[model samples]
Target chain A: AQRVTQPEKLLSVFKGAPVELKCNYSYSGSPELFWYVQYSRQRLQLLLRHISRESIKGFTADLNKGETSFHLKKPFAQEEDSAMYYCALSGINTGFQKLVFGTGTRLLVSP
Target chain B: EAGVAQSPRYKIIEKRQSVAFWCNPISGHATLYWYQQILGQGPKLLIQFQNNGVVDDSQLPKDRFSAERLKGVDSTLKIQPAKLEDSAVYLCASSRTDGLENEQYFGPGTRLTVT
Candidate 1:
């Protein structure tokens, strides 16, 4: 079975400080990974995907297959950046992209 | 374009009761999905629909949970004889079928509380 693991249940950081939310995965084949974010009272949205190699909202995640990790990082944290973060992988079940998500990490940036 | 829409943002029911949540996907989206999110956990895929057909329901507790996407546009998820463990948020999301990067759009979600 495939699984995603976000080791941090909560990460608290001061505003302007660097932030890193760790994510690891267990899968047998090459993986397609993504980071999703949910802000206060907002719907869950895609922050970035490893395949696109694009940065969104100053956040970036690099897929390290050797390490089996795709950690999300930002140079500086902002108050507005406090939200729930989820790491997901597209499962290879029947060719349809079924997302397998981690337990999630809540990031809180304080002033 | 309008995002996915879900109704009854919150619901409460007793154990052994029944409840349902509704969802309408974005226009022309060919794929729809349902997920369950516990209070402190990430959303888990409960079901997936492709144009009114079930692509996957492997995670759904079929004995107590059921869902239908009729007309391939609107969907409803039902939980009968609800359990306390079923308290969670039910989220609806949809994605287009054309591109390889099928980025999903999500709804506000229906929060269920079974006491």
Candidate 2:
């Protein structure tokens, strides 16, 4: 079974401070990992994916297979970055794409 | 393109009552999904449809929760005899299967409050 774990329920940080939202996963075979964000009054949207290896809005995450982790990081967090962040995993065995998401972390960036 | 669309942004009903939510995936997208998100938990896939055909529905509570996609375009999820525990956000999402990267686009979820 594929499972994504985000231990922190809430993460608070000051504007311009570095931010790291930890995410861990459990999957038998190679799985795709992703980070999705939901802003206030906005629908959920893809923030980044491990397969892409590209940063979005100054945020980046690396899929560490050995550690079974894909921690999202940024040197500095902006006030607008405050939102709910969810880590999701997609198992390759499932013929089609089906996501398993983790308990989200509410990020609060204070000015 | 217009993102996935869902109706009745909010719904409130008493336990045992029935409710239904609608979803219209992005044009040209072949896959549609329905998810249930509890207050403190992430969205859990309830069912998936591939062009009007049921693809995955392992987690869906078949006894009371039912969903369907008609003509391979729009979908609807109906929950009969709702329970208090069912009060949560019902999210609808869609993705294209043209490539290996199946990035899903989500709709502004419908918030259901079961009193």
| lDDT of model number 1 | 0.93
- Where does model 2 exceed 4 Å of error? B98-100
The local distance difference test score of model 2 is 0.93
Name the best candidate (by lDDT): 2
Separate DockQ for every predicted complex: 0.65, 0.69
- Clashing pairs in model 1, backbone N/Cα/C closer than 3 A: none
Over 4 Å off in model 1, which ranges? A92-94, B98-100
Candidate 2 per-residue C-alpha lDDT over A1-111 given as tens digits, one digit per residue, 9 for 90 to 100? 888999999999999999999999999988889999999989999999988899999999999999999999999999999999999998776656789999999999999
lDDT, candidate 2, at A91? 79
Docking quality class, candidate 2: medium
User: Residue A30 in candidate 2 has what lDDT?
Assistant: 84
lDDT of 1 at A73: 97
